[model samples]
Each structure stands twice: as structure tokens, then as C-alpha cells.
Target: MSLKRRLELLEKKANYLDSGVKIPQDFKKFNELIGLPISKIPPFKELPIFGYEMDIISNIETHRDYALNKARGIGATEIILRWILFRAVQNKIPGRKFLIVTGIRLGLARDHIKRMINLCYNIPGIIKQSSQYNITINNSEVIAIPANPAAIRGYENVEVIFADEAAHWDLLDDDPVLEAIEPHRTKSNAHVIVVSTPNGRRGFFAKIFHNSESKYYKDVKPWIISEGLLIDRVEVEKVQKEDYYRFEQEYNCQFLTVRYAAFPPEVLAILQSNSMEYQLSD
Candidate 1:
């Protein structure tokens, strides 16, 4: 049978075992191998203080690939990273791995990993101790790898791919890091999440955001915040009247071109969401 078909069988057998029906003694071991209850797994909601639209997470849960480019302070990285951790731990499939790739140094990478580790450690019933936080409930690995092309090419069978700070990578050079991981997602249920704040002008992220197939192009869940969000409209006009063009376009989520002008006032209205209603204490 194909790997996909075999996995389906294992899933079916696991469900039957969960229902407490009597299977043959020989099949007991197989059930133990595959069955992973949610209560015994780590809860991902414990990480980071994110305040984004519900529709954003809904899109991620439904469609696996997302290319999100937005202004800073939108909580893009934290939201996606938390989602990755949540999915990895909640469904404890053996050999499952989630890789977080970044253009920053290894130390910075560990900072994010450490946040995830602490979240897992603090949650009481969700995740039991399993070799610290580097490994998950059923030995599923949540790893952070640097953006070097050579290092990324070695991994296989990764379930989720998160490319953070994507604007830092050069799109013209064939993007070996993306090339290596894209093919490994042969499973129909794989997820690829790319997120970044605006950086200068051109890059791999810019191309992806422009493509029609990209989630951004389709307007899955756009929450564009610019100077208008932070400062009063008339106040901004007075502070940088001559350079208002620069401040509005760069700090705001505006796409600058020679002929076309700033976003119509109506488009910004369509993209913006209300301030996040935080439930972190819950």
C-alpha cells in the first residue's frame, strides 16, 4: 500500500482502539504505537501574546500555504510560530517535525525556541516532560534551523515549514532553502507558513506576495496597519507634510509605484481589523 493509504489505515485502527472495543491482543501494540490523546499532548495556545483576527487562524487551519507580508507590530511571527507549536503537539504523530527557518543568527533562533520551550514547560496537563522541550509528547521534534541552504537540504518528512523574516532572503538566487523544503511536503496535509514585515523593496517575499496563488493575493485575512493606525490623520499630515509620502508608504502597508498612488482610502478600510480583544489571561 502507498504511504498515504497506510497512514489512513493506522488512523482508523487508532480510532477504534480509542473507542475501547476489544481488538486482538496482537493489535494492542499497534494501537499503543499510533494512538495520541489530546489531553496528553501539549497545548499551543500558551505561547506568545498575539491579538489577530480569528479569520487569520481559520485560514491557516484550512489552507496549508500562506505568504503574509505586513507592517511591523502586527504580531505576524509570534502568531504563526505559536500555531506551528500548537499543531505539532496537539496531534502527536510519531516522526512528525516542524522546522522554523530564519535569516537571523543561531542565537536569535534559540530565543524563539526558548519561548516555545518555556510555554510547554509551564502548561500543566498538556505536555509531560520528554527530554526537556526540544522533543514533544511522542518524540515529535520542533526544531529551529538557520537559513543556510546546505543545512535545510538534509531534513525530510517535515510536517510544517515556517519561514520567518522572509524579506531578508534573496529571491533571485533560486532560494535553495525554500526549494529543499517545498518538495518534502508530498503529504496532502502539509503546511507552509511564510511571514515578514516590509523590508526595503525586492526579495523572495515580495514575489510570493504578488503571486495570484498566494494567500495575500487572495486577501484571505488582511490586517494592514500603517501610520494612520498609530497617529491621527491630520496630525500625520502636519508632522511630515513634504515627506508624508515616504512616511505613509513605508511605515504603512503601502505598495509604492511610479504611476499609481497610495491605497485608496476605501481599500485600507477593507483590510483593517479592529484592535485585538486580548484573552491572554484565559
Candidate 2:
């Protein structure tokens, strides 16, 4: 039988058996049901869930809006994609939407959608249709697009939105991408998930992570030398010696002073202090 015919039969079977099928509420259970692929190598292996990953998932389950300031090479992205796929498949509401907004490029966003599709391959009747930018599963849809304000404003009924590499989003116009998402997310009451490594001491990601008043449940995980979860301690120490700034910003999760700035933060602070004293002397 053709792939189209096979899908038709699966849909028919799903419609008949849907009432009895139990969707797991816990993400771990759902993940076990459709095992997570560990590698891109053939005869793919199942990913063992890590303690930190489970902590991130627990935060996701508890909080509607979450921000993660993560170090490089952690499995934050993989965990999030699996959770999104789980949500897309289990959603019963018709025409509900999920979105992934990637930094600057539509192609990167589409790649995320593709990963979601790959996750669906083992399961039957979940994926109805898939393209580069969109996937239709049952009555719900998951879409991927660039972090462009005009493009973002066009989506509605969005149940969840993932802002990937959020710190690197173009801030030429003071982050209109986030500005655009705010109204849409507010109107839809959608869960907003922002994940990125530290870019600098700027952008929406940095602001939310630092702001205690922000609603996002923030989680920050750097390279734990004792645990050595994702990155090795020797490699981290090597980088720390080679490029201290890079180590601080990327691995230590510190929002360092922007490299291209005219003066260091201390110099600027001194200048401001001198000007204040000069005004008082006048």
C-alpha cells in the first residue's frame, strides 16, 4: 500500500480506537511511550533522561512561562522538542497551534519542525501532514517561523511558543520580535518558553533572566565540574584559560560586558561618578 493509503487506514483506525487510547499526563511517561532517539546514527538508540533534564521538565510542567539560561551542549533543546511533540499529539482541541521561533532564520525554525516530525515516525495516526514549516497532527498544528515581528503577529490560537536562541535575536530595533510575541501570547494565554545561552548583558533573554519581577520561572545551569553532565571539566578549564570571556559568558552563564562597547563597564561607572561630582561642585 502507498504511504497515503497507510495514513488513511491509520486515521480510520485512530477514529475508531481513540476513545480507549490513554494519553499520559506525565511527560516522562509520555516520553517512555514514544522513546526519545539519542543519536542520528542508524538503528537509533533511546536517550537516557538526565537529572537536570528532568528538573527542566518538572519546571515546564509546573510553570506556564519558563526561561532557561543554559550552558552550551546541554540537552535543553532536545528535551523541549520532545515535550512539544508530546503536546502536539495529545492536544484534543481542534485548530490549536504550537510555534517554534528560531533566531533570525526561517530555515533553522523549519529544522526544528523536521525534528518534531522525526519524533512522530514511530507512532501511528499522530502526524496527518508535514512540510518544512508546519506539521498537522490530528486537529492540532505545529508551525515554525523566524523571529520576525511581522511573521510572528500572524499566528493565533498558539498553545505554546518556544523562543530558541532567544539571546541572539536581532535587537536592532530593541527586540520587536518579543514585542510582537507578547501581545499574541497574552491574548492566547499560551505558555511561553525562552531558552538560550548568554549572549551578552543585553536582549530579552538577559532581561527576563535577571528581572525578579518577571513572571517567567527562570532556571540557570552552568557546567557543573563535579557532575560533568554535558561538557568535560578539562575542556572547560582549557577554554577558561584560552578565552576567559568566552568561558564566563558561554559556560559560566555570566552576562559579560559586550565586547564591542567603547569602554568597559567600570570606566563608564567612573565617568558617570565624576560627572555627578562635577555637577555638585558647580
Candidate 3:
């Protein structure tokens, strides 16, 4: 299918999921379907990404055939959680499924799922627990499973797939989770979202983000704060005084001249907590 048509289908599915419409036999098990209101769904507080809105509406409005390579604490997790919750409350397929793969295991997975539920319930009429292992807003269906690639063989046709901390996911030798989830994509017009900070110098996430040749590589967006943008003028001089050029690059996301830089120059530039205290008290 053309990417545009695929994106249109994706947008329709997202709208259906968000509005809490029941899936018909073509997309569900039965003929009749229902509708749920947006107020009854979980609400997400949008945050700044490179100073732009989180793009949840746009992200949900189309099929995400791409991945997100983001800095840590950049609101990637929060948005993905919102999308998964949307599906959980309104899935149409029999045994309609949503899966989250983290670097952690079952106990942690359950904890994360509970946190999502709390976020959903915290929003008032948007979400409520229909039963254990089931969350509903306007009859959406969502379940977050802690998965290791080796153990993820049985689940099929997952409607939404999220890979968290994906930079660390490559350490697993038998990552069947990726394999298991691929078939579901064509069938469900599946939405796959992967988010992580750079882990090593390179890996799956890195290759996809850095190298355009990878099959999964679609669109790449990088967010960087230019040097001197966040740093105080006084502190910039202090980093120069300390000769910590390497410390500055990592945090500031600047190009570095240092070899094997553990602490890039940009970070060192911003490391002047003592000076801030000195200024505050003075």
C-alpha cells in the first residue's frame, strides 16, 4: 500500500481507538460497535520536545513506521504510555493486545503497568479499572507485559508495540519479541514505537538512528542544545578555566575534539554548582 493510504488507515484506527469505537468483524469479532468519549479516556500532559509539543496527536493520527532516538528525560516514555493506555481501553480484536518490552522483568513490568494505570485514573473520568489485567476508559483494552525476547514466543498479532530503553535491548541474544511482533504489523496496521537514549557508541538503536541503511530506519530527528544556550556566561568561563573540555560535550551535545570522551566538554561547562551557590548567597 502507498505510505499515504497506510497513514490514512493508521489515522482512522487511531481515531477509532481514541474515540472508543467498538471494532466490527472486519476489525473486530462482531458486527455492532460502540463509541467512547475522549473525556472518559486518560489525559496526558504534553511536554516540550526540542521546544515543540509532544506530537501525541500527530503521532496517533498516523501509523508510526519510524522510531524515536531521543535524549533521556525527554518525555518519550510518558507519551508512549498514553498511546498504550488508549488502546487498552478500546481494543477491537478478540484478545486484542498491546505489549511493552523493557530492560526489566515481570515484577518491574507490573510496577510500570500500575504506574500507567495510576496516570490514567489520575485523570478523572478518562480511565477506570474494569477488572484485574484489564483497564477501560470507553471500553479500550490495554495490558503491559514485561518481556524478554527469549520468552516472548507465544503472543501474536500485538496491536501496539513499544520497546523501552531499546539501546540496551541488543544484549539479549534471543530477542524473539521483535520477531514475534513483526507479523502483527501488516495484520493490524500495527504501530511500533521505540525510544531510547544512546547506550554504547553503537547498537540496534544507534545503527537505526545513525545509519539510514537499516530497514527500520525511516525518519530521524535529533534534539541538541547548542553550547552557550543553557550554560551561564560566567560558568562557560569556569569550564574553560578548569580545562574540562570533555565534560562539556556530553551534556551540551556538542561536537568534541577529545578521544574516547567519557565526559564531554559541554557537560563540564555546566558543572559549576558551587558558583551558583556563591552567587545565590552573595
TM-score of each: 0.59, 0.84, 0.55
Off by over 4 Å in 1: 1-51, 125-137, 169-174, 213-250, 255-282
lDDT of 3 by residue, 1-282 (tens): 357745755565564456554333231211012211122113522222222223532554464555665533334465567546645554546566676777555554566577566655323355545443445554444555554554444566567777776665546442345565566567776677766655554445555655557556333333333222222446445655675543343223222344567786567666764466555553
RMSD of 1: 16.1
Which candidate leads in lDDT?
2
**Model 2 weakest 10-residue run by lDDT:** 37-46
Candidate 1 has an lDDT of 0.55
> Which pairs, if any, clash in model 1?
none
lDDT of candidate 3 at residue 215, scale 0 to 100: 51
Model 3 — which ten-residue stretch has the worst lDDT?
Answer: 27-36
lDDT rank, highest first? 2, 1, 3
TM-score ranking, high to low: 2, 1, 3
Residue range 175-272, candidate 2, lDDT tens digits = 68778877755788888888898988788888897788998899987877224545678888899999988999888889988887889999988998
Residue-level lDDT of model 1, residues 1-282, one tens digit each, is: 358746865676565445543233332232233321122123422122323433456666676776665555445555566566566655546777787887655665787777666544323334434332244544467778877677666766678877877765544453666676566556535677776655544566666756666443222222343223222456445534766555444336444442243775456556564325433564
Residue pairs in candidate 2 whose N, alpha carbon or C atoms collide under 3 angstroms:
none
The positional error of residue 88 in candidate 1, measured at the CA in angstroms, is 1.6
Q: Which candidate achieves the best TM-score against the true structure?
A: 2
